[model samples]
Target: MSLHCPSPATMPPADLPAPAPHTPIEDLQALITGCLFVALSILMLRESRLLTGGTTGLSFLIHYLSGWRLGLVMFLVNLPFYAFGLAALGKRFTFKTFCAVGTLSLFTELIPGLVHFDRLDPVFAAVMGGLLAGIGILILMRHGASLGGSGVLAIYLQKTRGWRAGSVQMSVDVLILSLGLLVISPGEVGLSILSAAALNLVIGINHRPDRYFGF
Candidate 1:
Protein backbone atom coordinates (compact mmCIF):
# COMPACT_ATOMS: atom_id res chain seq x y z
CA MET A 1 0.00 0.00 0.00
CA SER A 2 2.94 2.31 0.59
CA LEU A 3 4.98 1.85 -2.60
CA HIS A 4 4.06 4.04 -5.55
CA CYS A 5 4.29 2.64 -9.07
CA PRO A 6 4.98 4.50 -12.33
CA SER A 7 1.99 6.39 -13.74
CA PRO A 8 -0.19 4.50 -16.22
CA ALA A 9 0.67 7.02 -18.96
CA THR A 10 4.37 6.36 -18.49
CA MET A 11 3.99 2.58 -18.81
CA PRO A 12 4.67 0.87 -22.13
CA PRO A 13 1.69 -0.49 -24.04
CA ALA A 14 1.02 -4.19 -23.62
CA ASP A 15 1.88 -6.37 -26.57
CA LEU A 16 -1.12 -7.78 -28.40
CA PRO A 17 -1.55 -11.51 -28.30
CA ALA A 18 -1.08 -13.62 -31.38
CA PRO A 19 -3.96 -15.50 -32.91
CA ALA A 20 -4.36 -19.23 -32.40
CA PRO A 21 -2.77 -21.14 -35.23
CA HIS A 22 -4.80 -23.67 -37.19
CA THR A 23 -3.58 -27.24 -36.94
CA PRO A 24 -1.88 -28.79 -39.93
CA ILE A 25 -4.49 -31.53 -39.92
CA GLU A 26 -7.26 -29.01 -40.09
CA ASP A 27 -5.59 -27.10 -42.90
CA LEU A 28 -4.88 -30.25 -44.89
CA GLN A 29 -8.42 -31.51 -44.59
CA ALA A 30 -9.84 -28.18 -45.67
CA LEU A 31 -7.58 -28.02 -48.71
CA ILE A 32 -8.45 -31.52 -49.81
CA THR A 33 -12.16 -30.96 -49.51
CA GLY A 34 -12.04 -27.56 -51.18
CA CYS A 35 -10.16 -28.92 -54.15
CA LEU A 36 -12.44 -31.91 -54.48
CA PHE A 37 -15.57 -29.77 -54.44
CA VAL A 38 -14.22 -27.30 -56.99
CA ALA A 39 -13.09 -30.07 -59.32
CA LEU A 40 -16.39 -31.84 -59.09
CA SER A 41 -18.27 -28.61 -59.67
CA ILE A 42 -16.31 -28.04 -62.87
CA LEU A 43 -16.97 -31.54 -64.07
CA MET A 44 -20.68 -31.20 -63.40
CA LEU A 45 -21.05 -27.68 -64.76
CA ARG A 46 -19.13 -28.44 -67.95
CA GLU A 47 -21.53 -31.26 -68.67
CA SER A 48 -24.69 -29.22 -68.13
CA ARG A 49 -23.48 -25.66 -68.80
CA LEU A 50 -25.28 -24.68 -65.63
CA LEU A 51 -24.09 -21.83 -63.46
CA THR A 52 -23.91 -21.68 -59.71
CA GLY A 53 -23.44 -18.52 -57.66
CA GLY A 54 -20.36 -16.70 -56.34
CA THR A 55 -16.99 -16.27 -58.01
CA THR A 56 -17.32 -19.76 -59.40
CA GLY A 57 -20.52 -18.68 -61.14
CA LEU A 58 -18.71 -15.73 -62.63
CA SER A 59 -15.92 -18.04 -63.68
CA PHE A 60 -18.47 -20.25 -65.44
CA LEU A 61 -19.98 -17.24 -67.15
CA ILE A 62 -16.59 -16.10 -68.41
CA HIS A 63 -15.74 -19.60 -69.46
CA TYR A 64 -19.00 -19.81 -71.35
CA LEU A 65 -18.22 -16.57 -73.16
CA SER A 66 -14.58 -17.38 -73.93
CA GLY A 67 -14.40 -21.19 -73.94
CA TRP A 68 -11.74 -20.97 -71.23
CA ARG A 69 -11.27 -23.26 -68.29
CA LEU A 70 -13.81 -22.38 -65.62
CA GLY A 71 -11.43 -23.50 -62.89
CA LEU A 72 -8.61 -21.29 -64.10
CA VAL A 73 -10.95 -18.34 -64.42
CA MET A 74 -12.36 -19.07 -60.98
CA PHE A 75 -8.91 -18.93 -59.40
CA LEU A 76 -7.84 -15.83 -61.26
CA VAL A 77 -11.02 -13.94 -60.53
CA ASN A 78 -11.02 -14.78 -56.82
CA LEU A 79 -7.44 -13.54 -56.39
CA PRO A 80 -8.57 -9.96 -55.97
CA PHE A 81 -11.21 -10.82 -53.40
CA TYR A 82 -8.61 -12.14 -50.93
CA ALA A 83 -7.64 -8.65 -49.87
CA PHE A 84 -11.21 -7.82 -49.00
CA GLY A 85 -11.42 -11.04 -47.03
CA LEU A 86 -8.27 -10.29 -45.05
CA ALA A 87 -9.49 -6.87 -44.06
CA ALA A 88 -12.98 -7.96 -43.11
CA LEU A 89 -12.65 -11.56 -41.92
CA GLY A 90 -9.24 -11.50 -40.17
CA LYS A 91 -5.99 -13.38 -40.86
CA ARG A 92 -7.04 -16.91 -39.98
CA PHE A 93 -10.12 -16.78 -42.16
CA THR A 94 -8.15 -15.09 -44.90
CA PHE A 95 -5.46 -17.72 -44.81
CA LYS A 96 -7.94 -20.56 -44.85
CA THR A 97 -9.87 -19.01 -47.68
CA PHE A 98 -6.67 -18.39 -49.59
CA CYS A 99 -5.65 -21.98 -49.17
CA ALA A 100 -9.07 -23.23 -50.16
CA VAL A 101 -9.28 -21.03 -53.23
CA GLY A 102 -5.74 -21.83 -54.40
CA THR A 103 -6.20 -25.53 -53.89
CA LEU A 104 -9.51 -25.44 -55.67
CA SER A 105 -7.99 -23.57 -58.59
CA LEU A 106 -5.13 -25.96 -58.94
CA PHE A 107 -7.46 -28.90 -58.78
CA THR A 108 -9.73 -27.40 -61.38
CA GLU A 109 -6.81 -27.05 -63.78
CA LEU A 110 -5.38 -30.47 -63.06
CA ILE A 111 -8.56 -32.52 -62.90
CA PRO A 112 -9.51 -32.03 -66.55
CA GLY A 113 -6.22 -33.46 -67.76
CA LEU A 114 -6.39 -36.41 -65.42
CA VAL A 115 -10.10 -37.27 -65.54
CA HIS A 116 -12.75 -37.51 -68.25
CA PHE A 117 -16.17 -39.05 -68.62
CA ASP A 118 -16.88 -40.87 -71.89
CA ARG A 119 -20.68 -40.55 -72.10
CA LEU A 120 -21.64 -37.35 -70.39
CA ASP A 121 -25.33 -36.63 -69.73
CA PRO A 122 -26.32 -33.06 -68.95
CA VAL A 123 -28.99 -33.88 -66.40
CA PHE A 124 -26.83 -36.28 -64.41
CA ALA A 125 -23.99 -33.78 -64.58
CA ALA A 126 -26.09 -30.97 -63.21
CA VAL A 127 -27.39 -32.89 -60.23
CA MET A 128 -24.07 -34.54 -59.37
CA GLY A 129 -22.20 -31.31 -59.80
CA GLY A 130 -24.55 -29.56 -57.44
CA LEU A 131 -24.10 -32.32 -54.91
CA LEU A 132 -20.32 -32.31 -55.12
CA ALA A 133 -20.12 -28.54 -55.01
CA GLY A 134 -22.48 -28.50 -52.06
CA ILE A 135 -20.48 -31.12 -50.21
CA GLY A 136 -17.24 -29.32 -50.95
CA ILE A 137 -18.69 -26.03 -49.72
CA LEU A 138 -19.86 -27.72 -46.57
CA ILE A 139 -16.36 -28.98 -45.90
CA LEU A 140 -14.83 -25.54 -46.40
CA MET A 141 -17.44 -23.92 -44.15
CA ARG A 142 -16.78 -26.41 -41.38
CA HIS A 143 -13.07 -25.67 -41.61
CA GLY A 144 -13.53 -21.88 -41.90
CA ALA A 145 -12.21 -21.82 -45.45
CA SER A 146 -14.10 -20.10 -48.26
CA LEU A 147 -13.80 -20.03 -52.04
CA GLY A 148 -13.37 -16.25 -51.59
CA GLY A 149 -15.34 -15.05 -54.59
CA SER A 150 -18.67 -13.44 -53.82
CA GLY A 151 -18.14 -14.96 -50.41
CA VAL A 152 -15.57 -12.26 -49.68
CA LEU A 153 -18.10 -9.56 -50.42
CA ALA A 154 -20.78 -11.45 -48.53
CA ILE A 155 -18.65 -11.73 -45.43
CA TYR A 156 -17.69 -8.10 -45.60
CA LEU A 157 -21.28 -7.03 -45.96
CA GLN A 158 -22.38 -9.24 -43.11
CA LYS A 159 -19.75 -7.89 -40.76
CA THR A 160 -20.03 -4.22 -41.66
CA ARG A 161 -23.67 -3.88 -42.64
CA GLY A 162 -25.36 -6.83 -40.90
CA TRP A 163 -26.56 -8.51 -44.09
CA ARG A 164 -27.11 -12.22 -44.64
CA ALA A 165 -24.34 -14.12 -46.47
CA GLY A 166 -26.81 -16.49 -48.13
CA SER A 167 -28.89 -13.66 -49.54
CA VAL A 168 -25.89 -11.76 -50.87
CA GLN A 169 -24.50 -14.90 -52.48
CA MET A 170 -27.85 -15.83 -54.00
CA SER A 171 -28.27 -12.38 -55.53
CA VAL A 172 -24.89 -12.55 -57.18
CA ASP A 173 -25.64 -16.00 -58.53
CA VAL A 174 -28.92 -14.83 -59.98
CA LEU A 175 -27.20 -11.96 -61.75
CA ILE A 176 -24.59 -14.29 -63.17
CA LEU A 177 -27.24 -16.70 -64.43
CA SER A 178 -29.26 -13.88 -65.96
CA LEU A 179 -26.33 -13.20 -68.25
CA GLY A 180 -26.78 -16.69 -69.66
CA LEU A 181 -30.01 -15.59 -71.33
CA LEU A 182 -27.90 -14.02 -74.10
CA VAL A 183 -25.85 -17.12 -74.99
CA ILE A 184 -27.86 -20.04 -73.59
CA SER A 185 -31.57 -20.67 -74.16
CA PRO A 186 -34.26 -20.14 -71.54
CA GLY A 187 -34.44 -23.88 -70.88
CA GLU A 188 -30.73 -24.01 -70.14
CA VAL A 189 -30.99 -20.97 -67.90
CA GLY A 190 -33.82 -22.65 -66.05
CA LEU A 191 -31.71 -25.73 -65.52
CA SER A 192 -28.76 -23.58 -64.44
CA ILE A 193 -30.98 -21.83 -61.91
CA LEU A 194 -32.21 -25.16 -60.67
CA SER A 195 -28.64 -26.41 -60.25
CA ALA A 196 -27.75 -23.31 -58.31
CA ALA A 197 -30.82 -23.65 -56.14
CA ALA A 198 -29.84 -27.22 -55.35
CA LEU A 199 -26.34 -26.15 -54.39
CA ASN A 200 -27.69 -23.47 -52.04
CA LEU A 201 -30.12 -25.82 -50.44
CA VAL A 202 -27.38 -28.29 -49.62
CA ILE A 203 -25.09 -25.60 -48.20
CA GLY A 204 -27.86 -24.00 -46.16
CA ILE A 205 -29.16 -27.16 -44.63
CA ASN A 206 -25.89 -28.99 -43.97
CA HIS A 207 -24.09 -25.87 -42.74
CA ARG A 208 -26.52 -25.04 -39.99
CA PRO A 209 -24.70 -24.27 -36.74
CA ASP A 210 -26.78 -26.12 -34.18
CA ARG A 211 -27.23 -29.21 -36.33
CA TYR A 212 -23.69 -29.90 -37.51
CA PHE A 213 -21.19 -28.99 -34.82
CA GLY A 214 -17.59 -30.21 -34.18
CA PHE A 215 -15.34 -28.87 -36.86
Candidate 2:
Protein backbone atom coordinates (compact mmCIF):
# COMPACT_ATOMS: atom_id res chain seq x y z
CA MET A 1 0.00 0.00 0.00
CA SER A 2 1.17 3.52 -0.83
CA LEU A 3 -0.11 6.96 0.17
CA HIS A 4 0.39 9.92 -2.12
CA CYS A 5 -0.24 13.68 -1.58
CA PRO A 6 -0.02 16.55 -4.04
CA SER A 7 2.95 18.80 -3.47
CA PRO A 8 2.26 22.41 -2.47
CA ALA A 9 3.81 23.67 -5.72
CA THR A 10 1.45 21.45 -7.76
CA MET A 11 -1.70 22.27 -5.83
CA PRO A 12 -4.54 23.86 -7.80
CA PRO A 13 -5.29 27.48 -7.17
CA ALA A 14 -8.54 28.38 -5.47
CA ASP A 15 -11.25 30.12 -7.50
CA LEU A 16 -11.88 33.74 -6.75
CA PRO A 17 -15.37 34.76 -5.68
CA ALA A 18 -17.56 36.36 -8.35
CA PRO A 19 -18.76 39.90 -8.02
CA ALA A 20 -22.29 40.34 -6.65
CA PRO A 21 -24.99 41.20 -9.15
CA HIS A 22 -26.46 44.67 -8.87
CA THR A 23 -29.94 44.98 -7.40
CA PRO A 24 -32.70 47.16 -8.87
CA ILE A 25 -32.37 49.56 -5.94
CA GLU A 26 -28.60 49.82 -6.50
CA ASP A 27 -29.20 50.54 -10.17
CA LEU A 28 -31.71 53.27 -9.37
CA GLN A 29 -29.38 54.95 -6.90
CA ALA A 30 -26.45 54.84 -9.33
CA LEU A 31 -28.63 56.25 -12.13
CA ILE A 32 -29.75 59.22 -10.02
CA THR A 33 -26.27 60.03 -8.73
CA GLY A 34 -24.70 59.63 -12.15
CA CYS A 35 -27.24 61.96 -13.72
CA LEU A 36 -26.69 64.54 -11.01
CA PHE A 37 -22.92 64.57 -11.54
CA VAL A 38 -23.28 64.82 -15.32
CA ALA A 39 -25.82 67.64 -15.04
CA LEU A 40 -23.55 69.55 -12.71
CA SER A 41 -20.66 69.16 -15.16
CA ILE A 42 -22.81 70.48 -18.01
CA LEU A 43 -23.84 73.47 -15.91
CA MET A 44 -20.23 74.36 -15.22
CA LEU A 45 -19.30 74.10 -18.88
CA ARG A 46 -22.30 76.22 -19.88
CA GLU A 47 -21.34 78.91 -17.39
CA SER A 48 -17.80 79.08 -18.71
CA ARG A 49 -18.86 79.07 -22.35
CA LEU A 50 -16.64 76.03 -22.81
CA LEU A 51 -17.30 73.00 -25.01
CA THR A 52 -16.59 69.33 -24.31
CA GLY A 53 -16.58 66.32 -26.60
CA GLY A 54 -19.10 63.63 -27.65
CA THR A 55 -22.83 64.13 -28.22
CA THR A 56 -23.07 66.22 -25.09
CA GLY A 57 -20.61 68.68 -26.64
CA LEU A 58 -22.64 68.71 -29.82
CA SER A 59 -25.68 69.61 -27.75
CA PHE A 60 -23.76 72.50 -26.23
CA LEU A 61 -22.73 73.71 -29.67
CA ILE A 62 -26.32 73.56 -30.88
CA HIS A 63 -27.47 75.37 -27.79
CA TYR A 64 -24.94 78.13 -28.41
CA LEU A 65 -25.71 78.45 -32.10
CA SER A 66 -29.52 78.12 -31.97
CA GLY A 67 -30.29 79.38 -28.46
CA TRP A 68 -32.08 76.10 -27.84
CA ARG A 69 -32.17 74.51 -24.43
CA LEU A 70 -29.11 72.31 -23.81
CA GLY A 71 -31.21 69.67 -22.11
CA LEU A 72 -33.68 69.55 -24.98
CA VAL A 73 -30.94 69.40 -27.56
CA MET A 74 -29.10 66.66 -25.65
CA PHE A 75 -32.25 64.58 -25.36
CA LEU A 76 -33.01 64.98 -29.04
CA VAL A 77 -29.47 64.20 -30.13
CA ASN A 78 -29.53 60.94 -28.20
CA LEU A 79 -32.85 59.77 -29.67
CA PRO A 80 -31.49 58.42 -32.95
CA PHE A 81 -29.00 56.20 -31.16
CA TYR A 82 -31.62 54.22 -29.27
CA ALA A 83 -32.32 52.15 -32.38
CA PHE A 84 -28.69 51.14 -32.55
CA GLY A 85 -28.57 50.48 -28.84
CA LEU A 86 -31.61 48.26 -29.00
CA ALA A 87 -30.30 46.37 -31.99
CA ALA A 88 -26.80 45.84 -30.66
CA LEU A 89 -27.15 45.91 -26.88
CA GLY A 90 -30.55 44.22 -26.42
CA LYS A 91 -33.60 45.27 -24.41
CA ARG A 92 -32.30 45.59 -20.88
CA PHE A 93 -29.24 47.64 -21.85
CA THR A 94 -31.28 49.86 -24.12
CA PHE A 95 -33.91 50.41 -21.45
CA LYS A 96 -31.31 51.34 -18.85
CA THR A 97 -29.63 53.63 -21.34
CA PHE A 98 -32.94 55.28 -22.15
CA CYS A 99 -33.63 55.83 -18.48
CA ALA A 100 -30.16 57.28 -17.95
CA VAL A 101 -30.50 59.64 -20.91
CA GLY A 102 -33.93 60.83 -19.87
CA THR A 103 -32.86 61.33 -16.29
CA LEU A 104 -29.83 63.35 -17.42
CA SER A 105 -32.02 65.47 -19.65
CA LEU A 106 -34.39 66.32 -16.85
CA PHE A 107 -31.58 66.91 -14.38
CA THR A 108 -29.70 69.27 -16.70
CA GLU A 109 -32.90 71.30 -17.09
CA LEU A 110 -33.67 71.40 -13.39
CA ILE A 111 -30.12 71.95 -12.06
CA PRO A 112 -29.94 75.46 -13.47
CA GLY A 113 -32.66 76.64 -11.12
CA LEU A 114 -31.23 74.87 -8.08
CA VAL A 115 -27.59 75.89 -8.40
CA HIS A 116 -25.97 79.09 -9.57
CA PHE A 117 -22.32 80.00 -10.02
CA ASP A 118 -21.57 83.70 -10.25
CA ARG A 119 -18.12 83.33 -11.81
CA LEU A 120 -16.54 80.17 -13.17
CA ASP A 121 -13.03 80.22 -14.59
CA PRO A 122 -12.61 78.42 -17.88
CA VAL A 123 -9.69 76.25 -16.73
CA PHE A 124 -11.43 75.24 -13.54
CA ALA A 125 -14.64 74.51 -15.38
CA ALA A 126 -12.90 72.44 -18.01
CA VAL A 127 -10.98 70.28 -15.53
CA MET A 128 -13.65 69.83 -12.86
CA GLY A 129 -16.46 69.46 -15.38
CA GLY A 130 -14.55 66.75 -17.22
CA LEU A 131 -13.78 64.89 -13.99
CA LEU A 132 -17.38 64.99 -12.80
CA ALA A 133 -18.74 63.88 -16.15
CA GLY A 134 -16.21 61.06 -16.30
CA ILE A 135 -17.17 59.82 -12.85
CA GLY A 136 -20.83 59.99 -13.76
CA ILE A 137 -20.20 58.02 -16.93
CA LEU A 138 -18.15 55.43 -15.03
CA ILE A 139 -21.06 54.92 -12.67
CA LEU A 140 -23.47 54.55 -15.58
CA MET A 141 -21.19 52.07 -17.31
CA ARG A 142 -20.78 49.90 -14.22
CA HIS A 143 -24.56 49.63 -14.03
CA GLY A 144 -24.86 48.76 -17.76
CA ALA A 145 -26.25 52.13 -18.84
CA SER A 146 -24.88 54.93 -21.01
CA LEU A 147 -25.58 58.54 -21.92
CA GLY A 148 -26.40 57.47 -25.45
CA GLY A 149 -25.12 59.00 -28.72
CA SER A 150 -21.48 58.07 -29.36
CA GLY A 151 -21.48 56.12 -26.13
CA VAL A 152 -23.82 53.61 -27.72
CA LEU A 153 -21.55 53.39 -30.73
CA ALA A 154 -18.52 53.00 -28.52
CA ILE A 155 -20.05 50.12 -26.61
CA TYR A 156 -21.19 48.47 -29.81
CA LEU A 157 -17.76 48.72 -31.37
CA GLN A 158 -16.06 47.46 -28.23
CA LYS A 159 -18.31 44.42 -28.05
CA THR A 160 -18.16 43.58 -31.75
CA ARG A 161 -14.56 44.37 -32.63
CA GLY A 162 -12.67 43.96 -29.34
CA TRP A 163 -11.87 47.65 -29.25
CA ARG A 164 -11.49 49.77 -26.16
CA ALA A 165 -14.51 51.97 -25.57
CA GLY A 166 -12.39 54.81 -24.25
CA SER A 167 -10.24 54.80 -27.38
CA VAL A 168 -13.27 54.73 -29.63
CA GLN A 169 -14.83 57.59 -27.72
CA MET A 170 -11.62 59.62 -27.78
CA SER A 171 -11.31 59.31 -31.54
CA VAL A 172 -14.90 60.44 -32.06
CA ASP A 173 -14.45 63.28 -29.62
CA VAL A 174 -11.33 64.49 -31.41
CA LEU A 175 -13.28 64.78 -34.64
CA ILE A 176 -16.13 66.57 -32.91
CA LEU A 177 -13.79 68.99 -31.17
CA SER A 178 -12.10 69.74 -34.48
CA LEU A 179 -15.46 70.82 -35.83
CA GLY A 180 -15.85 72.94 -32.71
CA LEU A 181 -12.83 75.00 -33.78
CA LEU A 182 -15.06 76.76 -36.32
CA VAL A 183 -17.55 77.95 -33.70
CA ILE A 184 -15.54 78.33 -30.52
CA SER A 185 -12.39 80.37 -29.92
CA PRO A 186 -9.05 78.66 -30.43
CA GLY A 187 -8.26 79.10 -26.72
CA GLU A 188 -11.48 77.39 -25.77
CA VAL A 189 -10.74 74.61 -28.23
CA GLY A 190 -7.45 73.96 -26.48
CA LEU A 191 -9.21 73.80 -23.13
CA SER A 192 -11.82 71.52 -24.63
CA ILE A 193 -9.08 69.14 -25.70
CA LEU A 194 -7.72 69.17 -22.18
CA SER A 195 -11.16 68.37 -20.85
CA ALA A 196 -11.56 65.54 -23.33
CA ALA A 197 -8.23 64.10 -22.28
CA ALA A 198 -9.28 64.21 -18.66
CA LEU A 199 -12.57 62.55 -19.43
CA ASN A 200 -11.00 59.81 -21.54
CA LEU A 201 -8.22 59.20 -19.05
CA VAL A 202 -10.79 58.22 -16.48
CA ILE A 203 -12.38 55.75 -18.87
CA GLY A 204 -9.07 54.45 -20.09
CA ILE A 205 -7.80 53.77 -16.60
CA ASN A 206 -10.89 52.44 -14.83
CA HIS A 207 -13.35 51.12 -17.40
CA ARG A 208 -11.32 48.32 -18.97
CA PRO A 209 -13.37 45.21 -19.69
CA ASP A 210 -10.68 42.91 -18.33
CA ARG A 211 -10.65 44.70 -14.99
CA TYR A 212 -14.35 45.42 -14.49
CA PHE A 213 -16.85 42.59 -14.79
CA GLY A 214 -19.95 44.13 -13.25
CA PHE A 215 -21.50 45.13 -16.52
Per-residue CA lDDT of candidate 2, range 69-109, in tens? 88889999989988878876889888988898899999999
Candidate 1 lDDT at 93 equals 75
Per-residue lDDT tens digits of candidate 1, residues 97-168?
777777887887888787778887777777777777877777776566667777678767877899986677
Candidate No. with top lDDT = 2
Q: Tell me each candidate's TM-score.
A: 0.83, 0.85
lDDT of 2: 0.79
Instruction: Please report, in order, the local distance difference test score of every candidate based on alpha carbons.
Output: 0.70, 0.79
Model 1 weakest lDDT span, ten residues long: 1-10
- In model 2, the clashing pairs are none
The backbone clash count of each candidate, in order, is 0, 0
